[model samples]
Target: MQTLHYLTLSVLIPPLLSFFAEPGALFFEGGATNVGMIMDWREMAGRPTVRGMQGEDRWNAYYGAWSGGKQLGSGWVEGMWDGRTDPMRGWVIAFSWMFASFADIYYLCILVRRPRLLLDFALTLGFSHIVLTTYYSASIPTSLFFWIVMFTWSATTVTIAEQICVKREMTEGLVISPPRDEVDDLEMGELLRRD
Candidate 1:
């Protein structure tokens, strides 16, 4: 659990600080770099019109998805992100991660045994980005935030699984062999034995 907590926080806290307190907006004012930011986002939404996409009225024809549930050019977008694209959008995305991280901190304090709660928190955080996106009027930052929460939650779940497996195995005093590629696993065995 200490390992999980440490790993979770490594990716968690900095983004939280950036989220609450705009990081480096001092220099990204509407300028060339900022223009690049706008271009980057448009290009992603612009792929449907590419030359090779001929006969493709919609990109959905390739993804096996219908246009109805598809979220197209309209949705919740954080108004705050538009004005300050570089640092602003960056900051909003960072804020989402920060919220996830802070939630992890809460999980550590309250749900150490009920790991399902940790998994739920991460998944909720990931999906929350979408809700927040809609609430913010459909924006790219929401997508980015979703990615952050997904990653954190996945990592937490993995750590929890490993810990549960290790505990179950240790009760029998069984010597489980480490994978061949995992040199670190040998050291982990020694460390776990000491515990």
Candidate 2:
């Protein structure tokens, strides 16, 4: 049950936060009125069919270089950037991920109150992303950049969470006083010793 809870939160939270961070790209058409960038769900999920195109045609349309002019079929179009093909959207997504990682520290350290499991939770989140991307894309992500980003995010989360948790644990109050009877007995012994 505990494992289930951890897995659920670790796997679900970051992506959900990312989506929320940039909802216009996912929900609004073309991300903006003039952008000509549409969220290609089929391409994102690695399905072969997209707007009556299939196989190589679908792949080319979605992943091919931008040629400009009214070509809504291609994922990369003029004035618009998908994270894969351009740096603008890539940076936006990176920021979103950073925000999510910060939230993870609060969730794991303060809310869940399990500082020791911070590393495990951070690793679980990274591994979950890999598994999810593979499942959705129907193939393992072969990009070196993707792996590097995942590692960086996980390492950062763990580092920050560990520091916060350690600080919290260190400042926690300690109970040094004995029970009432023990204190009375010690007092009486001290009195006798003094006599």
Instruction: Give the top-scoring candidate (lDDT).
Output: 2
Off by over 4 Å in 1: 1-84, 87-109, 139-149, 157-195
Worst 10 residues of 2 by lDDT: 32-41
Model 1: per-residue Cα lDDT over 1-195, one tens digit each? 433443554455344434443443312222222322222222112111111224644432332211335422221144322222233444433443445455455554344444445555555644554454444333353245445544765575546544664565466577766677696878789899999
Q: Please, what are the lDDT tens digits per residue for candidate 2 over residues 72-159?
A: 3344567553423322344444454566676667677876455788888778767776676566545676656555656777888889
lDDT of 1: 0.41
Clashing pairs in 1: 75-137, 75-138, 76-137, 76-138, 77-136, 77-137, 77-138
Residue 65 accuracy (lDDT) in model 2? 27
**Model 2: how far residue 79 lies from native, Å:** 12
* Model 1 root-mean-square deviation: 16.2
What are the per-model numbers of colliding residue pairs? 7, 0
- Clash pairs, candidate 2, are none
Question: What overall lDDT, based on C-alpha atoms, would model 2 receive against the true structure?
Answer: 0.52
Query: How displaced is residue 66 in candidate 2, in Å?
Result: 15
